[model samples]
Target: MEKPNLFSIATKELSQDAFITWLLQWADDKYKKENEHLCLLGKEFAKSLIKLDKKLNAENIKIAKVTAGRQWKNIDIWAEINDDYALIIEDKTQTGQHDEQLKRYKKIAENYYKGERKVICIYIKTGNECNSSLQYIQDNGWYIFSRSNFLAALKAFNTKNNIVEDFTSYLDNIEKETNSYQSKDKLKTWLAAQGFYLWLEKQVTDWNEWNYVANPSGGFLGFWYYFTACKKTKGAEIYIQLENRFDSGIDLCIKIGADWERTTEHLYKVYGILFEEAKKFNIEITKPKRFKAGAYSTVALVKNAFTTTSDEKLDLEKFLTVLTNTENLVAEAALKC
Candidate 1:
């Protein structure tokens, strides 16, 4: 049997406070190998200090103390180095730093240390949304440790302990998936996935035959690629809209837009052809809307093209297949137009 990684499991199951406490334990000198007075974590973290501000001295690396959550109004982390320097870290996992949060922590650290140490605040974030706090952090001369860099630092000074190694790998995987737009559980991640999808659209779609357009705003639920004016018939336009909805399964709406003309015949032909094409691939089409709002256009909704969940969970590999399939259908129908 494989060794189970409890540290990885705890990070997901345990509360933020507990996880922070665990990190605090590792940051202290007591966690280091026997007889090592030097704080291994403080030493590694101090390296980050030099990277953030070259003015800070990196030599004579001895962390006097490492503490967290006991004093100074629950400031996430506090480290005193060589009895004269302090590093205050505010670590965030799911949330971004609030306005003046880091600033407030800096003041608290300074007051607690009481002119005994030079202090600097560092914001350590795992999430990708921090645009709002960037200027504030910059103005306050605070440093930021993004997910990627933080993981890199952890990997560099690993203690060769199995638990620590597993935890590091867990964080590494999370950063990779989140940064690459592979996880769409959050709104920001979903938008990133859409941005990547738009890039794929530009690469695969022919501008002369298809005109690609994104949602007017990121707040919108969906966007589409439609046939150009030249390729569109007076009564119908071939298009595919990829929709993201919280209460509905993944939808790839293959629609035929039409004017006020008699388009029932065109609608029948297109719907039949689309239904047959979808059947060939075991994709069941539903929610047939023929002549919506008195317009001659028709819509055939294909559900579960990527996922069965109603949430904005995107499966990129399956989505690419759906996009290609929809594009082929639209292209085939365009030849008739």
Candidate 2:
């Protein structure tokens, strides 16, 4: 049996925020005598935030104060270093930024400091997200502290503290679960499917957006790109959607966002173009037996979309080629319409 971990049970964002706050608090000089290792680790974390500013040298920089949660503008974590820099961390587990919260948080921090200290905003996501989401964070002026980056910092300390060890172990386990798709012959769990989606997000360069869509039946990881506006319907567009449920196959579909009448019209137009283009690439995409019309409806599908290796493992390269070819097909078809 696996050993019990508090973090594995207290998996909420509040729990993670508390852990980060506790670690950052140890950076103060008062904690050096209590536990030297923790103090050093805390200081290292403080440095990680400070190092984001090219003008600021984190070496020999001393932390003045550390605050977390409700104490300071409801920010997840805040650290004041040497009267010159204020680091604000907006921590997230599986959620993405909404309601322009990143911009709002940065503005709040800057206004609070009022030009006295350089406010550095960091967005830390410990869970999996698509590259497009990460890019959006960067575009909004927040430095992204990813899962791999956090793991690298924690592993570097090699501390014996039980709290640190447990947290590290928990995070490492999550990382392994998300990466298990590489070795497994099938996508057997939600984490494995998420891993596969993340991998595809990284490999497919032409996709405009990718995210997890929640539904009553079950959530699906969806990728959308090659948007072609419908010439007939206003505020309607047709795009290629790759929906993966880890059921040993991917649904390569052409979807539209409009009412049923316009959706069917746009879907068929784009579907016909893709059908012709796919043949040239030796790809097989067939019309679904039945088409449903709704806000987002699938008009066409590519059956058995993924190619497999001899041992029945996923063929990453061949599958990627198919996806890229599909994108090309959509792009070419968009021009004609």
Candidate 3:
């Protein structure tokens, strides 16, 4: 008999009540057989991470690792993307890891930072234990993922299976299915079987991270090519972080004009260049319409709300001139330095 996935079990035809009992029995058998003290978990996880990359990217999004899988004490998969950056992924099967995992990675990533301001760490865990190990994994200020997450993972899986095919059909299915009582009962049973009932209530997700090194040009680079070439659709998100250190960053808003339309030869560039000459430069770069909490509105907000090119407005030009001049000076100084 073949192993049943969450969907097959949920949507499988069987009595609502007895099906739940059968599902748990199956999960217990499979969980015990495979997870036997989390055996072969590392290999399983490495395989899944490769799949996750393929599911996340919708376009020609690139992904790779700077390093290959070596049985390091605290790390697992190390890869890269776009030939421009790297992602260090560590997978654990059981509850979690010891406290010093991320601290240990310092020795590994210290070598890979070739003045490249881009990198990420991924953790694809079997269980949903989010504590210090994972927290510290992220606190080091690296991009991390424990798992693809439940909803996100499901959506990706469905897309791969060609279940609903498009967004409209997906939404329609959601509306039709979630409203009925039988569906809810089947779902509850499925959750209970997998030991995911309480976990679902708590909203658990999979993310996990760490670091290691061997040869950037050898196996590491080979794995990088493996991930980048096969998996094109990858999901990514970027955000800033501050932790009572009084560190400040600048804010700049942008509009996706040509990038979204995929037209024109010019690539719109947005990068931060801090000017030591002009302070009070800690502004968060964002799109024109998005107003962060506690931020005062600019004239651009009131009048040119719909327009993306708020750069053309008057007051914005003045304020931006000061910022650009500062950035230009900083760039010049850096070049000189």
Per residue, candidate 3 scores C-alpha lDDT tens digits across 1-337 of 4333443334322222122122222222234454432222222222334444443442443222223433444455454433444456555533354666755664476555664734445554533343534566667644344333423433433222232223223333333333321221232221221222222223222231112113332211000000111011122111111011011211222211211222221111112221232234443232234322211111111112111133332243344354343333333323322
Clashing pairs in 1: none
Best by lDDT: 2
For TM-score, the strongest prediction is 2
**Model 1 Cα lDDT, one tens digit per residue, 180-260:** 544454423443544444344544544322122343333334555555331545645677765555234335677655442
Evaluate residue 117 in candidate 2 and report its C-alpha lDDT on the 0 to 100 scale. Answer: 87
lDDT tens readout by residue for model 2, 183-292 = 44446566767788787766655556777789875877777877767554556666788777655445788776754354566567667876787787667888876665
* TM-scores of all predicted structures: 0.50, 0.88, 0.30
How far does residue 254 in candidate 3 sit from its true spot (Å)?
54
| Runs off by more than 4 Å, candidate 1 | 1-42, 49-51, 59-71, 182-337
Model 1 residue 219 lDDT score: 32
